[model samples]
Target: MVEVADDRYATGSGASPPLHAPRPEVEVVTAAKRTRRQREAATVITADARCTPVLVRAAIVGKARMPRAALEILAPNGAVIGNVALPNTSADFDLHQRFWLVGDPTPGSVVAIVAEGGRQIILPGSRLRSGPAEGQDWSGVACRMLGWERRVAPTDAPAGFQAVFSSDHPTIDGPGFTKAVRRFRTAAVTIPLVFFGFCFPFLFVIPRLVQSGTSTLSLLVLPVLGGGLMTMWSAHCRREVAAQAELVEGGAARWGKEIAFTQSYWASMRKPSAAWDGPMPAAAV
Candidate 1:
């Protein structure tokens, strides 16, 4: 019989560890770093607006520095109607007096502000309809900025566009108030259902406990059912809110990239051609 060398029992300076030896585990963690532009984008202070059928006016406030910022008015189909240059200053400016025409006055129109460094802000638009405007039969869209009067000065919008910002504006109109009312109505309906659901399990559990005159495993069922229902409802509400917030955030980011691309295209288009180079002579070699 031939004897094979046993490396597991070998002890020497060059000996390697056994194959069955356990190796230590290490966890590596990496964190993403945000650029200056991303930091500026995430710090949007607030964007407020007052919309009318023909005109859309808005104000944006922030703490970042945006040079040569311009507001671009977009049509319902995402076509750029025009862009108005904003003052070159910090991001804390207002557009109280500035307003633009819809040209077509179609619904679903939106507004965006793009700056030199690709910083952009998008504001939601209001729905339009036929309503009373300054004692005249006019059909237009109107949306008032929430808490605008308390935060900023009264809007100096033109006469025809003034009614949208006042109390005369339609109660059921504008996405601002419409969304608020919808959420309120939802809460009003769901609160009662949740309360009844939590109590519903108790009604049967208590009656059985009283009749039996002894504690049983069925007692755990009421608490478990009630807790599960509440947890599910709370999770649903949280997911809804988070989804809406993410939609707004994703839209803003996408719009910013588009604006940056458009700006670069225009810049390249306007760039002057370099001096023409003379033709090289092939015989010089």
Candidate 2:
């Protein structure tokens, strides 16, 4: 195991962490309600679109450096975009922004997002070779020393091509996409049902029993009825299940070997660990 001699994660205070780049476009307004770093990160992604979209293939890399203060987003003109704090995740990234691609660079602009600190983001036409980070890798490792969990070999891209996460990139092109679809299916079913089941008694049974306190039988019957209602609701949501399955099939068709990588990452970021109400890490980049 590679020991982080300078394990930034070792700290408990609201200090910066190891790995990733910083945007020079924005000034950190430590006065804001968020950690100084998080606020600064959010400001960078949205300001001047400091993250202007380009047609670049992206790959993850890690480099050890003297930990810098949470990065600042720099303006194209070399001025700070603004002095403000922000939520951790990229402000505007949504279902449409996350994707993987295998094609030429296309004309026109899309929003580039800053996520997972500054290290995780989409670059334009990078053509970086990719392989697993924490898990096993069949391909040879590039550099174990650099923190970049994955290495992307650069490539020259052609013109007039485009891909979107929901559309082209799902065709099972790589591990990223494969993980995406699998996670989506597992989470889609688990998340809602888990929460619904937990809340059933308090939200439904208790209320009904309270109103029908007139009879002891109401207590027993209401509980059963609530359970039945929950079962019915789950049954009624088969269409949602089908939709998830369809996306799984669709991703394989669209991206080939890759699954829905972006979707999965997004889901993980949004999902609470341990419990539904458990606080999540600032959206994993």
Candidate 3:
């Protein structure tokens, strides 16, 4: 294999890994001179507003750099118009916003969005090209990046062509609430059964046996019952531990993928890793 020297690929603490590098630069002729543009977009001005009814195609380009877990579109002057979400596995998730498209959208229009770091990015249309990054042809069917802009139908839009504003902020899960809920729901079924089966002999079953003058039989049954209950509870606890482990493992996997995706999104745009949180200047329409 041929070794290649890469300088732009290295960076700081939060720098994305190598495989997550941004798309390479494209050299296109302008005024008989070479101008290189990377095929990626970032979010800008994630506000909500009213917009004129216009139909168009679009795709989400980034999930990180998104102002919120969801993204909304704004007009050139910063008016809310539409919204959409980064697509998940099954559902067509959407952000909430109200704004309008002034013209028929094509391949290179800049869509306004609010990125994760609370700054704005006026994402350019050119970032989305025909093929995958390696193909060097970004001419694929247009689909908005997640946590970015989205297309909307005039009829499906809010009254007056305005859209609502929404987002899944604080991007990370809160206070382990989800984990607690899962533990509670699961234990609801297992805990009661364990107690009745294992500890009830010392409370009710033994007393009943003594009152009935069946102490010997009680002695024989209680031990066996107690042992079986203990075994079942132990098994249940083991399963719970395994399930919790799987959950933690899954979360780590998701976080890794998100980090990778974040890097790829900006790298595709040819932006430095710090740009995610750096200042973004306003776009001149």
Q: Each candidate's TM vs. the true structure?
A: 0.23, 0.25, 0.21
- lDDT, each prediction: 0.32, 0.30, 0.33
Off by over 4 Å in 2: 1-214, 244-285
Candidates 1 and 3 compared: the better one by lDDT is: 3
Model 2: lDDT to the true structure: 0.30
Tens-digit lDDT track of model 1 for 1-285: 001123354466576877886422211110023224322322321222222222223223211112122333444455544433222221122233233232223433332232211111222222222221121011011011211112222577687665543665433334533354344334434564777787787777686776878565667666677667665654454344333322322232222322222222222222212221122111110
**Deviation of model 2 at 59, angstroms:** 14
Candidate 1 — which pairs collide?
A: 128-141
Off by over 4 Å in 1: 1-210, 213-215, 249-285
Of candidate 2, the 10-residue stretch with the lowest lDDT total is 138-147
Off by over 4 Å in 3: 1-51, 54-95, 106-255, 258-285
Between candidates 2 and 3, which one is better according to lDDT? 3
The residue-by-residue lDDT of candidate 2 on 1-285, one tens digit each, is: 000123344468667754673322322212223343432333323322322222221121222111111112233344332111112222222222222211222222222233323323322211211221222121112111111123232344332222232354323334443444454445444655665676666555566667766565655664577557655654434333334334434322332111122333333333211111111123321
Better of 1 and 2 by lDDT: 1
Ranking by lDDT: 3, 1, 2
Count of residue pairs whose backbone atoms collide, per candidate: 1, 41, 49
lDDT of model number 3: 0.33
